[model samples]
Target: MTLTIWIDDWQIQCCGESFAPGDVVSWKLLEVDPEDYADVVGSERAREIDCREEHHGQGEGQDPTPVEVVSVTEVHCRYGVPPGAADTMNCPVPGTTVLVPVDEADGWAKARPDVRFAGYLVTARQVRGGDSDDVSAAELPRSPS
Candidate 1:
């Protein structure tokens, strides 16, 4: 059976290998908890998108799940941190971030030796502090003339 997986940006940045569409990969999958990520992904989205984390460390006895990469999308999320609160809340945005697989009648007709599935990758980008109008050139130290 085909399954939708959520691969976080940090996982790829830390120790994930480069993968593209049509590439069959073996990954350690973990069941996602919708409530845990409801802040970033709205309650509805959290349930739709499955498989949140991929464990890189060794010692797990579970075998890696091999899957074919059907697509890859860069998910852009704009969030806001409430005053006095440390956690960020999701903002109302058009379109859903969840990657739902398209059903193909003949896609899995032939069964392979191993159970292979089709999935997509979602990568998110976050921007932090930077130069702003509040900080003027005069505030910075002068360079040698």
Candidate 2:
């Protein structure tokens, strides 16, 4: 079963660094089974395995690929101006830039050095051409899984 929970007024801890919150950020939660260490199809482990398989014969010319644990749950992020205290997790005003903290950015970066958490920062903008509000849990479709 999957559930959607709202996170508001939170601080994210990066690699020994912390970011203040001021904007609304969305993230997908990836739940991994601890007992099921076998690689799940189409999962990060499977992708890594595919990568290694593709470069198995590349020899010294190939770039080193690092593999790490595939266990991940929730991922959160934020982004550009200094954070001002906000009482809720609502979206910020349009054109507002703020620095957002990415979940496990430091750890992820260590595994994939080319990745940077700063790239997750985003500027807020108005939602157009869709339902901008009223995304209550009751409105979401539920599954029996």
Candidate 3:
């Protein structure tokens, strides 16, 4: 199974299937309020989950822990939203804020294996520190003073 990390409507969440006992997944949960995360319970709480082979034998003793996770985060961007968008009851427009992994422009396109371009035009720009990288001075080299 693969580790999938994405921003849902409420929080930055992650999950993995077919994970065995003692497995661990380390992740950084950003764009989520600390209060909301700490208060997670019920169907959302993943603390000490159980994962074991069913055909091993009759239930006995404590079940093995499914997985362990360690997270560190800072609350920034609007919860599961593109920065600068005003908060409202309506859902944000899809495809307008396509999240891509950090990589070169060509590399990012190659990474999107599931997306296909049928005819619609799309623009790809490098966003560095919430701003366009094209206007950054970091792109230039320094000369001896």
Per-model CA lDDT versus the true structure: 0.44, 0.25, 0.24
- What 10-residue stretch in candidate 2 is worst by lDDT? 46-55
Task: Summarize candidate 2's per-residue lDDT along 1-145 as a digit string, tens digits.
Answer: 1122211222233212222223232332122231222111213322221111111222334332222222222222223233584554433232222333344332232223222222222112212243233222232222122
Q: Over the stretch 2-28, how does candidate 3's per-residue lDDT look in tens digits?
A: 111222222221232222223342222
Candidate 1 lDDT by residue in tens digits, 14-127: 677766666666666565554544544556655655454365653266556555665554433433445566667734233333433333212222222322222223321211
The candidate scoring highest on TM-score is: 1
Point out where model 1 deviates above 4 Å.
57-59, 84-145
| TM-score of every candidate | 0.52, 0.19, 0.19
Report the candidate with higher lDDT, 2 versus 3: 2
Report how far residue 97 has shifted in candidate 3, in Å: 2.7
| Candidate 3 TM-score over all chains jointly | 0.19
In the predicted model 2, the residue pairs found to clash are 78-100, 79-98, 79-99, 79-100, 80-97, 80-98, 80-99, 81-97, 81-98
The best candidate by lDDT is: 1
